[model samples]
Target: MADQQTLQKMRQLVDQLNEYNYHYYALDNPQVPDGEYDRLYDELTALEAATGTWLPDSPTRRVGTEPVSAFESHQHLAPLWSLDKVKTEEELINWETRLHRQLGDLANDSLEYMLEYKYDGLTINLTYENGLLVQAATRGNGETGEAILAQVKTIGAVPLSIPYQGTLEVQGEGVMRLSIFEAYNKTAQEPLKNPRNGAAGALRNLNPQVTASRRLDLFCYQVGYCSDREFESHEAMLAFLRENRFPVSPHLRKAAGIEAVAREIRQMEAGIPQLDVLVDGVVVKLNRYDLRQEAGFTMKFPRWAVAFKFEAMEVTTRLEDVVWQVGRTGKLTPAAELTPVEVGGVTVRRATLNNFDDIQRKGLQKDCLVWLRRSNDVIPEIMGVADEPDAACSPIEKPHHCPACGSEVVEKGAHLFCPNTLACKPQLVAGLAHYAGRDAMDIDGFSEKTAALLFDALDLRSIHQLYRLKLEALLPLEGFQQKKAENLMQAIEASKHRSLSRFLYALGIPNVGKRTAGDLADHYGSLERVMAATTEELVALPEIGAIVAESITTFFGEERVREAIDALLQSGVTPESAEESPPHEATAFTGKTVVVTGKLSTFTRQEIKETLAALGARVTDSVSVKTDILLYGEDAGSKLTKAQKLIESGKRSDLLLMDEAAFRRLLSE
Candidate 1:
């Protein structure tokens, strides 16, 4: 047993570490250096070891435990309800009108509305008893959820104990920050396509370690059940949550009229890009608890509140069929052939199903109305089934063989791959095209058709074979005149002296994108060093994860890859090392929101966007209240008009309108 003085020291260390954690994780403000915190943590850990005991609220509990076989079902003290949603201002007005009619005698009474962001992440219900966190669960079917106390404990922001002594059930959304999401995707083996999915997948993982790795945060929004207290209004409940040291959103607003509520919603939509988490829309609810009680509940949702959703990013469409496409890696990916529907002003005819496991998880079937979402101009993705499949709907069949090469497929993790790498036409064509892409080697005129022609006619079986091409052989090909052949040969020769980063990207390494490839090139400074790097060395880098490290090592270890690399080097290919540049300095654009409009003479859309990003600017596609600068070029369009209107209305007084010349001056300065 520890002496009183020793025990006191342990208590002090526990409290200090917890406070530091709260500051760093919950508030994004570090109160102590990592080294100092580590020292205190070590002291506490040592004391626990010596005494064979630890406090219930000790931060050491956060290191996580072994994987659980399964999650037990937990019944909530109070039921969680789903909210009704509306898309348009007219529908919102109708909802308010209905509320006024329901009030009847109090129709003339002034009503107040509470507004909050509708976070697009997994919903969680936490149960606390006698000031200690007793249980945590998903909002599964409202009444019952899978117990995830172990997983929830791994989240540093989540309180292990609170001030209140009575039992309480608090509701919040579990979300992964967009910044963290981007960092994680840099080296994730199967990169998470969505932040919501990242949070949801992490929380449900059998291993608590997996949950901890995601670094999810929770935003408490409601007290579902409180044994010893009752709140007068929604604002009061939020105050109570804040008092309890819970992480609450800072954007809560109260409005007296429907017009004010609508204005708040518009502002919220405009400021979406500034947020660190995904939010679908704004949630509006009655302010007073008494009014909520009077309004009562419907069968599915509370009558007092409704979610005012933004314009539809997701729409229901029939999945007409599933097509398996082979990539450069020979991996087979399922693509959904959808009955065409408009989403975010674009017509979407197809969506990515990801893999066979994804299809099974989403319960997608042919002829079903599935919800497809398109965001950030990426390929549309099927979120889930919107409705039950009719009898005519058939289960999506997984391919047993490669669709393109007719080779027997091999299962690797959640995906299927073709074993016949050399003979696969689709794989060779894709690989060749990828190597010649502007981002890879800047090889001009090397289209997919050209790749196919070379493969079919000249028996070009490998990437290294491209260097073996001669003018006489190329002259016999369909599109190769003497001048064209000479230009093609010159382009191919020029690619040999490309940067090491581009060469790395052109290698078609699994899980490696341009960013990760650049990171590898920068870290190693040479192809030989990167190829020879051990898994431990690779994993030591901040951006590289265990799976990605293993992938790099495995790819380099393959005999075929080694031989191909050697052949390329022997054919006079010399990839130059990365050029060191000065660290990025803060500029007028740094940490500011920028939106570009119209065609530019100096830079293409992609070029300008990349430049802004390099200078630390958050480039968005739309004009918003939070936008700092609108860079306009020739024939500026609606975005320019919107920015002008915002400025004229004094909604965005600080917003700047910069023409090409002005932007150039700012860059120079």
Candidate 2:
């Protein structure tokens, strides 16, 4: 039934598009005009649409399609922690003070800090082995991520193969260039919302061909895992990366301390108008890699680095109305409904007002003109009223009763609280949503409306009740079919087998995020062990401070929490024991940096690399300053000459040249 003519046409279009992309992006030389390219693209798109035929290299896939049912998880070699963020100089000073406290005598009066612009785009983990790109993943929950190698290889900035024949895992931000983003939006039938979203969406898009078409760029910053390479400092590492033809920031700088870093940040921000892409903030990092190791990390971020976030990008918009929202904890907060204004390229319809105090202080009213700011952050905040004396409308009043549950509202210092946490519509819905969120139970197709329906009709008040949902009960719902019902029940049943780390995170313990949950999982080893942990035991664990210990104990002590666990168990929901993925033995030269000097007679290039991939080895061809082991084989030449010169040099005094028999013995091991 396959159409040969259609397939041939698709291949021809793909080949033509590949050439166009090479000329435009790779060579910066376009053989075809924009109009002519667009016409050809349209024709190919039409042809592909008619037959529903798509090849991996097809250019039309750049537009992308619907999401997959679920994203397959890939465990990271190391956790991708976030950076500690500060919005004010005072906070930055406090962060520096903490760093000083940790460093003590090690603080070099004024240490050198590396400054670089922070991109507001998705973070990616790219791994290379034997010089070929093998794996690419998103920073999902830091430790576990979704593999997107097919899409990542399409990036113009990322090399499919590097010259270095060792294992390397690099971390970077995937971003869209402004000129390309704007041009795509102009021609797109349904335009992208923002630059960050466009960049993230294109990579996560299931169609690799589409991702290739987007022309996304990778800004590699950190080396997560590197073998057969050693650098004295972060700057040295950056230099090595640049030497390998990796895209690095030209604006990278070394500053003395907080003040110097701040000055650099100001310069970067001032020059933002001249740049094409967006930058949310500037990251300040300790220069020395050895110091970075000693500084270590907190539960969330690195102690060696801190991010200075910029103030929100401001724009004026009309305040349509104000609405009070109830959080999962029954806390009441206010948000302003705006007249749909585009702020910093993202459409802003609503902004947080913080609280009733903020609203009263600002004298905010309906139809009032407001100034909205969309900072380096995702959510925009309403700064204050822009119009003088505001628009002619009545001031917002505090509610006597909770809006969701009709319970009497309680007034706290400067906030409102609803006591009926379980019964309140918003709180209950929010709690259920959080419980089923992607990072938690990963329950697919469970929306707020569905939660509300389940709560009202079936009295689904607890997390355990979710597992008790039956197909017969689901059939009475507004939109229910035999196949859909079966799928929902199956998904619910599948969630019972999630790992202990995810289950712990799903419990919603205070101050415990995904990373913290992982720490608990690794320390305790199982859910049962975690439940049995005393406050003293918890506090003793690494990264588990006194406050976190108290929170964990307090959550477990709650009768409601116990009852929920019991019900879940009764419903046959049992989390799997925490298990880490198999570790990769990237190279055979363990504990020693290796430099392959000459030609080898025994093993072919590919065969030797394939063997090295099975062991812990760091193999490089460069005979430079930090090579620990130099292995010269039969018919060896230039690399041998370089190694001999480096051997005479005092910097590489500890370097050792071993016989091939040692490598053979390593192979036996």
Candidate 3:
């Protein structure tokens, strides 16, 4: 237990730290000496580690675990399809060549491309019902997603309602400004590690009140499903979304060819930092909708549009040392402490080595020169060791035991885990922190520091003890203001009404991510039913493989887990059941394989895919002899020719071509 003196000292540290952060990040002014700041931070880290009690807003909790299980599948009213990727000028030229080959003499004398910044953030689909903002969901599995309407409503820049009367599907990236992240950090609160995380966390908040305060913003880029109005080109679509009061990125540009598109990408990369939001790459799309249809689409991405990822920022640095850090998942990852070097645009000092296998594969060692790169503002990663190294350099070795708990570590594939999951303090504390994270249960005000403090200071074990906390008892503890204490309790209380899918996700069951959680909820209806299911029963469900089924069953079988569920129930955490669906029935297209290629004049690619799925057809991106139908849209390409060949060979009678009118009728039936 923390003594009174230690608690008091911690409070002072928090206040002082917050002030320093506010100055450095928010105001770009330093109040305290860097040495002094480091000293205080180190002291706090040590104290928290020693005493096991942490303040809620400590900085150490930023890099969270929960390797995004599967993204919840969301059936976008408009499909959130990916733009194809291109690496070199040759590929871009080849695309242009293909366009000319298909169009022949009719190929427009001049084709234009629309280039825009590809904001590196979560993709969200916003639905406006009768001019009123009604729903927002992530592009999960391109099919379904968690409803994050409450959190999305908090973003001041996102209009609560648009002026349009017709149903509209607006697709955009939810973004956070670097300036805001810095400002938030300067307030002595934890600084967001990156804009993507900041935006994701803000948009997933259970409390719109908290999300509203974060100043998150959006830039709508596409019109998914539109009831009325026609756009002739990609440029027109951008103008439409903007005219409809959707915030569009200002860096949008029109280019004539691959050269112009490449130049635009370069310009954007050079000037991205000056923009309000972070951008990872550039998106280039065929301007004319007719051209887009002609170009058609691959299985996963559109043929007419492509996302050109900027070259990863890389630099050569010395691998000074390697260290092991235990995460909330009890997975021990290796981190390299490097001699400071500049990569891309940022100074780099550290990089993640992944695990033991990665270390061995990379042949990393002390004093060895290594190339490091950062992809999408994530942690810098060691690319490879330099060809030449000092002869005196020593190789880095992996540890056999856990650093925190001294438990024997075992390698599971490429990852190393502490088998002593129940007893490891770091794992326990990390798990609790993840459970209360914004994307999970989103127990606001329950920061990592606070969770640590509660765990160490109060002997709190499971998430259940959190509910037993009284404001009066908390007030006496370090850094607990009466208002803050009350707010924390209220947040916890509010989380009881959290969605059943989110609750299951927050449980952090192995192999069961957000997408799997939604599927389980849809299948079983409630948590109780899921818990009651056996491994065999779970495996019988769609997409639940034996590995995932075993993990789910094992998680439920644990006594500690059972006790945690009981505690949550006692705290009045009621899980709402998922709405029931009609019984499964046979469909006309059942057991048939359908491939959609090129652009359909009748519907967007997403709509066609979803319609086919509804009709019980397995819609594939590629064409083969097994394919029963190849839905030919305008400007059908090589895939269309392939389908014709199959027809000529008398191999298939199911090859069908439907124009806009015919396809609409098919869907209506």
Candidate 4:
């Protein structure tokens, strides 16, 4: 056994190492040289191994562990309520008045407020016990959160071991530096939208390695829970937190009154351009903790704090050029190529013009200044042209031919199509890429370049050719190694067992996106049924219209499409459907034409279908004369009336109309 003195020395070493990590990772200023930190780390690791012990807060754990299947649920030490928001100063005045009303005699004439930038990032709740980081969770539903301990520990700014020994729950945001986000985007095949998105996605990733690679940063905003730590005011708490090496924002300021807060808000808005990362608003929190307790909270937001959100980020940029690119389905899309400009801290270079018709309708011209904006939670796009076109400016004209292969083009609905699927390089390459994408077949090593390489060298024309790829052909490729080639082959083989919906979606069927494919699978119950479905049968289903039905039939009608599917199936691509057995009361609704309407407390529309399917009943979306049973829940509408009409006319002779209560009673049998 190790001596008590040795254990104490080990604890000291651990603390020292964590401090070094903070200096190196967070501050970017290392006090000790790399050799010194490494020597101490190695010593601690050897000592811990010799003693057959592991510390929870050891910096060694920063290297991370095996991937977790899922984030574990954790109850918060205190509820993390969202702040009430105010866009205008008048709303802030009203909020203050409300706060005064709540405090009554306890209200101070002048309340000091701590104001800071409202960061656009994921909220993290960090727990510390005995000066060591114990757990880290997301804000989640406020009362409970998912334990992201592994991913959170990877963040250098988040202290592994602190100076104080209090059980504290610190609330902060996980952020990514704007520079880092841009740098990552430059190398990333699939680029991130913004720093906030990168940070949030990194934190939730199942793999700790992926999180660590993201180089996530942090900012501690508030102290949610602190045992053995008390302060008279919010500013005092922030100061104490900063003293313990937490990177509290230097932008945070204490204002004496509403006027002072207003001045600080103006100053913050002016300083936004100079700051790093995205700051969408300013957060104003009452400095006095006692005042906060008296004022308390609403069901969702805090009464003491309010977020003053800035207007949406908008800018004007010149459309330098327009390029037409072909999609997997040969749809020629026009995209605006712009001189790099920043919108909401994201460097924007390119955005889709949607269609040729939109370009013509908007009179979008090259060399014209366009209003670029990020609104309604979408990527930054050109809202409209701001400046009139100059004599030198040229409007993007509808293309007569494909840009990639110079083949003849034609108008399809509002879009232009190449109709050169047989020989178009872009279409073939795009289709292959889509087939190997994450949401599709999920082939790991196959990229657009690799697909093109195979297409050019080996006459690989279709998706099925991917399954036939061998180790010999991949060995000669520039980056391929023995292991890489083998991994790619394995991944390609593994894709053959994907679900029916995945296969259907992977085929790149017209008018069939991911959700539509899922709906088709759920409704048809198998791949075979979907393939053989008539246009009338497809259009009769909920949400699937005539256009979608026509697209489906048209796609399947193609000889190439049918052959490709056949080839895939022949290559052992077995699309499986999930089938469940009926319960003891399976025969209750057997052979019945059932139609459900309104919202049900007991079951969802999907669950009703699944239950009926197991019982050998036909579940239709709409009420008809053929429907033998009409199950109405709360708020029955047009369908209910239609079903009643059919029943009264003796069209559905044995039609039984019932509510959710009656339906449940029947299930109980």
Top-scoring candidate (TM-score): 4
Give me the runs in candidate 4 sitting further than 4 Å from their true place.
Answer: 1-107, 110-307, 342-347, 374-379, 515-529, 540-543, 577-588, 591-628, 633-655, 660-669
Which tens-of-lDDT digit does each residue in 1-669 have in candidate 4?
Answer: 568888898889988887776544333333443334557977897898798775677765442112223666788899887776677788788889998899899887887899999987778899876666767888765777777887897798988768887889999989887778766643342456556667878888755646776788889988889997778888888888898788788788889878888888988887876776777789999988898888887655779899887776777889999999877778777779987888766788887666876687667899898877653233465656777888978867778989999999988678788988888998898788888877777888888888888888888888888888888998987788999989999999999998788888888887576667887887788877898899998887644778889999888888988988999999999988867445345475776878876667766456787987777777765565567788887667667888888878887767889899987887786
lDDT of 2 at 27: 33
TM-score of 3: 0.52
Q: What would the per-residue lDDT of candidate 2 be over residues 230-251, giving only the tens digit for each residue? A: 7778899898788777888777
Candidate 3 or 2, higher lDDT: 2
Model 3 poorest ten-residue lDDT run: 62-71
Tell me the alpha-carbon RMSD of every candidate. 20.8, 24.2, 19.7, 20.9
- 407: Cα error in model 2, Å: 2.9
Evaluated at residue 579, the lDDT of candidate 1 is 74
Order of candidates by TM-score, top first? 4, 3, 1, 2
* lDDT tens digits by residue: candidate 1, 181-247: 8766533435576677788788887556578778899899999999989999999999999989889
Q: What is the lDDT of candidate 4?
A: 0.78
TM-score per prediction, in order, is 0.47, 0.45, 0.52, 0.56
Cα RMSD of predicted structure 2 = 24.2
Candidate 1: pairs in clash: none
List candidate 3 stretches off by more than 4 Å.
1-249, 253-270, 274-312, 578-669
Model 2, residue 453: distance off in Å is: 3.0
lDDT scores for all predictions? 0.82, 0.73, 0.72, 0.78
lDDT of 3 at 607: 74
Candidate 2 to truth, TM? 0.45
